[model samples]
Target chain A: MHIPDGYLGPTTCGFFYAVMLPIWAVASKIVKKTLKAKQVPMLAIGAAFSFVIMMFNVPIIGGSTGHAVGGVLVAILLGPWAACIAITVALVIQALLFGDGGITAFGANCFNLAFILPFVGYYIYQALTYRAPAISNRRVLAAGIAGYVGINIAALFTGVEFGLQPLLHHTAAGQALYCPYGLNVSVPAMAGEHLLIFGWVEAIVTALVIKFLQKQDTNGFPPKTCGNDTVGLNAETTNGRSL
Target chain B: MSFFKDSVFSDENASKNGFLQSLDPRIKTITFLLFLVQILLTRNIFILLCLYAVSVLLACFSKIRLGFFLKRTWVFIPLFSLFIAIPAIFSIFTPGEPLTTVKIAGLTLIITRPGLSGAALFIARVVTSVSFVVLLNITTKHFELLKVLRIFKIPQIFVMTLGMCYRYIFLFIGIIENTHLAVKSRVGIKIRPKKGQRIVASNITSLWQRSYQLNEDVYQAMLSRGYNGEPLVLNNFKAGWQDWLWLLCALTIFITIR
Candidate 1:
């Protein structure tokens, strides 16, 4: 779920941007480490794929269409950094070309989906994979849950970030922020709605894509242990390359 | 989804705040983030209402239609927040001062005030937050924004993808649309597409395969053009008079509301 600009108070967006930019800078370096020449186009194309897939309202729940950000799937195929950048780029294009997310909220949306998806989703994936067979169907299940959980976590971050807005003024003015809707209210709703359904879809799609990639392991980037230009990090790097 | 709708949300009064388009995306980004965090911390209804009102006014200044925003946001965000509201609705056990309660089979089940208050609070927070998000999306561009991010040294790898994804989103959607068109042209009958969902599914699989191949070709073309990891060099855009004025105005109004 893209958290557009101007959604929260000025101070809130400002603060969230402050926290997110540093992580994003780190994300960029992570991207550069494995950015072989061959993978550049794939990164861009994948970003585009993610945008369309996320925004393409699949008619579900009786004409109530739903779309996903394709975060987990991007993480699976392209590694977190590439997926992160790709999704960010896709989001930007979506914002500029179609007016999907806001201009001011670009940072917020990118932080929520692009940064959150790949790193968090990938980490969850690794946790699941570590406990599973190297190439078992259960790994697919793990990928699904990881995908689900990663998205929810991102949504939670958005809620927390959103929740922190009024607090900033108090912080700025040396007072206390109010708490009308406790973290209990906003955080859960964000996790449940923006992320939950997308999580299920992401899990399924991520599982299938992972399964598909597991079969070929050719068209995508090579594992890092391959240790060369050809050996771009794949989905597994999400665990703890900790770049 | 219409893939080019975001360009519409750029400032309607660009004549007044020209340099907002030129500010470092990173700084602008951080500013909005502060907005999100601050709003979330506020438990005061008065504060929330003030924030919500300011958000709406910003949209109005952008010259966007309120009806349009309501139609867009209410449809997805508010409508869906019912999930949170619904669950809280059932957890009502506290006795109320004759508050509205559901009765069944000569048994009266009281809807507690606290539970209802919780639900209302949940709805209000979600609506306000989501509304602001919609507002943000309505006002910015993705590339310029990401470039702002690039200033923070966010990797070119990720930036590359954002650019690619934006370009290819439209391309991929085009493929889907064209494929659908071709299918429609051939099907030419009274059969509902739903009845032939399996056929559509198979077609999608093939389409995915073809798109993959097409994507590879597109990559080759990019490389042929000497494409590197970095797609576009981050151009410098100075924060001018409008940028300062806009920022000051926003801050002043925000403080006043608070």
Candidate 2:
């Protein structure tokens, strides 16, 4: 899901950056107002956790191993707004320090993974688990479904972004200067792999994690009520220093 | 593990007494961004080649091993760019004047000239952009790069949070490595997929619990040390005449190419 530099046209890159700027600003404001002084360490630790989550490779079929992005899981634990900041921080480190993604396409990557994935996944999980018991199996199932749907949606958006490049930035001779594949090709190629393989990986990981947390910390199982309240913030405020 | 350590934690190259290391990091970062913009805008292969060569030369000047740098940048080229470019070169993607025709099992395939040129241009853009990005990363310390974010008017707290994230990532990496080793020792390498997923989920929960605890402790420590939401940093970034000259030269080159 990490788009490298030179894959998207300058105009496309600029467009995403413009779109993400306000989203990032609002997320920052919400986190800071809610977490206060605890925001710094909480967000930093969350981002670090997000970064390391990608390193754990789970067994797949035929001896293959795949890693989960863990975006939805983080959103389930923290609020979607906080997850947005955490994932964005991790992406910045990846792009600037490790070159895993592109500097120019950083905004685009963040829009997909940080904003779209977490917000969509959290809302889906919230809607499914509305008024359910804290430690019920229904919540776990909701998490699994949310993870599946969220990542697939993000993948579809990525495919559309790639598919639009040729239509938006081709030369006069009809030769694509950036990504050559049209929507017909890029969409299926991106969405197909996630739909078949990665979506399951994300779902299982998310469900299992929720199960484990339920067993370990039953009181903290459903951290926030399904409402306008930010995820994890109410719990943190009640505990008075526990992020 | 070693790759993670080397890529994220290693700063030997950044600390070296090299040309790039002597310049202010903020200046280096801005100039690199300009170079990237130029790389994205230009369509000429010669201009792309020149930018790539400049990146290579800069890497050499920064005391980075040419072999290591080349391997780092080129490895990504095929993985990310070449596969797409290869498909674009066939007549199926970019249909135009035929350059070479291949017949396979009663099917005729044509490689068009326009297709080849488009693919070449795409590859060139990828190479040049990747080279500059790698060069900037390898030559700049990670914290300095994080600090550079402040120039964009990013909040000081956010920058500090990013710096802390960089600091703790290695700690979590160590924890992950130890956990992986323990799992390998106990279960061997051939666990069932379901078991592996369970183990990963357990580990993730454990890590989260640890991080949550650490967050409280660190916050208390900070409060004790007069950290009032705004973290302070040592501002040692002084851009001298040489830095300005380098900036001027970069801008001039970009303008000339344009």
Best by lDDT: 2
DockQ of candidates 1 onward, in order?
A: 0.22, 0.66
lDDT of 1 by residue, A83-142 (tens): 666677777666544445555567777788888767888777767676454457776677
Q: Candidate 2, B257: how far from true, in Å?
A: 1.5
Model 2 CA lDDT for position B163: 90
**Model number with the top DockQ:** 2
Fnat for the candidates in order: 0.31, 0.68
TM-score of each: 0.63, 0.95
Interface RMSD of each: 6.9, 1.7
Alpha-carbon lDDT, every model: 0.57, 0.83
**Superposition error at A59 for model 2 (Å):** 1.3
Q: Report the C-alpha lDDT of model 2 over B197-249, residue by residue, as the tens digit.
A: 89999999888877776876898999999998778987878999999999999
Docking class of 2: medium
